[model samples]
Target chain A: MLAGLARQGVELPSACQAGACHTCLLRAESGDPGEDGRRGLKPTLAASGYFLACQARPVTDLRAAVAGPDVITPARVERRWWLGPRVLAVRVRPRQPVEFRPGQHVTLHRGNGIIRVYSIANRPGQARRDGLEFHVRVYPGGQMSEWLAGAAPGTGVGLGVPAGHCFYLPGQPAAPLLLAGTGTGIAPLLAIAADARAAGHRGPVTLLHGAAEPARLYLGEHTPPGLAGAGIRWRACVQSRGEDIAEAAADELAAQPDPAAARAYLCGGRGSVTRTKRALFLGGMSLASINADEFAPAAAS
Target chain B: MVMTSDPRPLYDRLGGKPAVDAATEIFYRKVLADPVLSPYFDGVDMERQVAKQAAFLTMALGGPNHYTGKDLRAAHAHLPGIGDEHVDMVIGHLAQTLRELGVAEPDIKAAGAVATSVRDEVLGR
Candidate 1:
């Protein structure tokens, strides 16, 4: 596809032609792009005909153009609360309802071209006018985090289209779900667990949240009543107290007596996400069954 | 042997993208289960790899060659520690996966030949 386009005098910006770098993203204005071309793009982008030029072998004639600037939805801060010393829970109300799943992320656009991606921490349409929820990790002097920490209700912000493939997927109600995260990464896992239960997931759902210490674990004291009722078990793993969260979570998963297939969702810092994924995969989880969302360092932010 | 000059691309004969997708699901499972190969893929997201593999396999089996020869060499050169043994093992897995999917012996051999044709570039030799 890339070659054909170049031959016809069309040049697409690209790097890592293997599709690792999404630099060659193009929008199909007319025809269907292969799923492989849209593989890791946000569901919303895929649905709207965005695809990777490097990966797509177009079966149908596609009228494609370079992806334009992201569409930004205006939003307002509705509420803010501290999840822990370092984690701030934020709720924002978009001007209109933003279609997003439980665990996908959106880029919060501050003025001056500054934007940061955050996972949506609540399921859409669950609470009236709740809008979107985000668990922002407050880094001292961090531009976006500091602003969000002090932002008042009605403070305006811009939201990029909901993006990312890490989200609660319906179907397979009986499949066991194992979720693990560290720090504010638990935000998405909470919503995913709730989404699963609400969808009538019957198999055991276990969530393990890891933090440096007990005091840093915000949800340790309170498991949402709705989640508790949904039979989702939540465990807090603290590293300061000698608990290796990844290993502990992997052990619990390996102990499951049933041979039923299980899916594991992991989030958090890149290192921890990679570590947990390796542990889970090594402990008999298939590579395809493990999903992860690694919080990239604020290089772009 | 009868299909040697069948005029149809091996990709079409082995079935199209859907067939490649099915073969990849089985192939990667075998690769990841192999102790020697699994280590190379540790901590990698298999879902994305599966998609990329499907595309690559489709090209290898005589589908649209989206990757330029240079792109192909660069892709393989970036993988650390990939050697002749690893390459052979990967091809073995692909062959086995096709066999499991009931692909004909001749078609499987043709696929193997196609894969081997690019072995030097794949190994960055």
Candidate 2:
């Protein structure tokens, strides 16, 4: 809600400030209740006239509420394994069931205040059978990846609520679903296919996970049990060094016969997402039918 | 003046929606009268064009960031031979509209500064 305000110069100090922090919390003593201002706030606090300024979009005049810390849950590492040379697959079990949709990202915080965000890779079926799976690549000198490298099974961790909108939607079961991405972007695509299959989508779901070389393709030989008999088809493409990932994916998407009948999702680097969206649009897909999530480079901490 | 809005944004201080409506109306009138800028809107729907300009101004003045129009470069890419003279004529019309609306001197200068910042992009340089 404050997104529009921020665009108009009414600056609100926010980080992941995702209503998890007191940064945007405000009171609505009187006036139009903000649209979902009470979302992350406690019921008692939300009921007695509290709301988050970041979440609250007041259609009418309103009083601001004071802020508080977001509720966080504890998670314990169940197990982990390396998918290939570069990608590490780590599964963590929260103490209790965590409500989240496939394709949403969660914020993980270490004990000493080191915070990192990662996408949850487990589909609903995988979540039930295993736990939350995360696909993390070890970037040189990356603190979060370093910590995960040494983290032991049963180690304690904290997770913020799941957030982001690049997930599969039910009720569109028959629409052709196109999921394409590079590198760790395969995590959300895996989860999306799992959820779509679980939701009984009979339509063709095509997933193209790309990398610079054949060895970097992590899920190449291993197909998920959930998608084995389901109607989901997965493919991996290896681009020569410096070959654009989106260009490679767009070539595949443009070959499809009916672009208008497909809902295409493209993820990964900003350049790839933007180029693929443009390519898809040029290939006859409506802009509204395209959904994209860009993993922009994080700023130097 | 009867103030019916909740709080004043920068757009409101510049006389709100009605002022934007009027400014676009007058600014285009000035533009269409000039030979340098007239051809750009020759066959365009004036009503639609006015709405787009108002939305652009609203965004530039710290109002709702709801402008859905193309970025300035993309919007002007089709025009041929657009140069400093065409830009001056367009900016002159906007400055005239702001002056006519009695939008304070500083605000008008600020608005002009904002417009000038996009000169290269608008010129597609």
Candidate 3:
């Protein structure tokens, strides 16, 4: 449905086009979205004609518009700082309570109509309330990144519905958590690890992050206090000049004991995510137990 | 004339997308659980694999031919270690999945025949 609409020159807000991300959610004013289309949506959202446009295959003519109030939350930049060369950490607080899991991503809408998907790096219900932190890798000549690099605090922005499958899921307190990511992909993994700890997970949690050079490894020796728990292992992997960070991270993860039984969350660039996912799978992890969030590069406008 | 077969396309007989979805889901679960077949999917995105498999199965069952004639052959040509045995194992899993899902004997056989028809292509012959 989304592709067909695009062919007709109607581009909808979309990311992770596989229905895992709710960035393309739309309100169907007329047609019925079958159960499959609303599979993971909240009952209330489904009741109000909301469906994932990427998943909807309407048999009859359908009219849908970008969702308003129900999906868009007004937010403001609370703080911004440089974590490393080309890495910016920004915090935004939603004007209204926007419930979201730590590792889920939100579509950040700047006033100028530029939007980019970013994973919330902080856990929900912190002492500061609804502040969402994002670790952004500012790319040279990237519109959103360039704007964000100099955006002042308190600047208004709109957030799309927070959606992603890579967040920490409860009810598996005893399953070991293995998180691996490259570059800013560590944002969501860190959030997921903190969430697991907050949920009182008793299993061991191991976090592995990799970067091209030591200077690019921002989170270096500072493991978040939230992740301080028994049997926790946090390691920053820095490879030699031209080595692939993704493979290096995957090698470390595959070396972990009992990879098959571990609940793994992998995020980062496409190559990194794919390599790490393959490593874990080959290391005996069940594909169902592995969740990956591959960052899609925004088309330069 | 006595009709020994239902004239409907196997896709319809298999009950469309929902049925194909169910079959493919069950089929992958079974394949992944089987040590012999699971390695073939190493590093392959399971979700995409399921979707592609569903589309291929749908076309094979005569629903829609979204696939080009050389797609299956071309895809398998690059993968190592695919032999006639692997093809048979996959067909067996497909038939077993339909059977477990309560598909009638004739329908399962028809589906198996469709899968078997692509045996050489799937084997990269």
Evaluating just chain A, the predictions reach TM-scores of 0.79, 0.76, 0.88
Question: Candidate 2: misplaced stretches above 4 Å?
Answer: A1-70, A221-226, A241-244, B1-125
- Per-residue lDDT of candidate 1, residues B12-113 (tens digit): 876677777766777776887799988778667666777777876786678876755676688777688888898889889888887777767777887888
Worst 10 residues of 1 chain A by lDDT: A14-23
What DockQ number belongs to candidate 3? 0.13
Docking class of 2: incorrect
A135-232 per-residue lDDT for model 2 (tens digits)? 98877787677778778999988766566677888886677788888888888878887788778887778887878787888877345565687767
| Model 2 vs. true fold: TM | 0.60
Q: How close is candidate 1 to the true structure, as a TM-score?
A: 0.67
Interface RMSD (Å), every candidate: 3.7, 14.4, 4.9
Comparing 2 with 3 on lDDT, the higher-scoring candidate is 3
Candidate 3 lDDT, A191-298, residue by residue in tens = 888888878887778888878788988887446565665456887767655666555545655665655568888888887788777656545565678899999877
Tell me which of candidates 1 and 2 scores higher on lDDT. Answer: 1
Which segments of candidate 1 are over 4 A away from where they belong? Answer: A1-76, A94-99, A125-131, A152-161, A212-215, A221-226, A237-261, A274-292, B1-19, B33-39, B42-48, B55-72, B79-82, B92-117
TM agreement with the true structure for every prediction:
0.67, 0.60, 0.73
User: Cα miss at A76, model 1 (Å)?
Assistant: 4.2
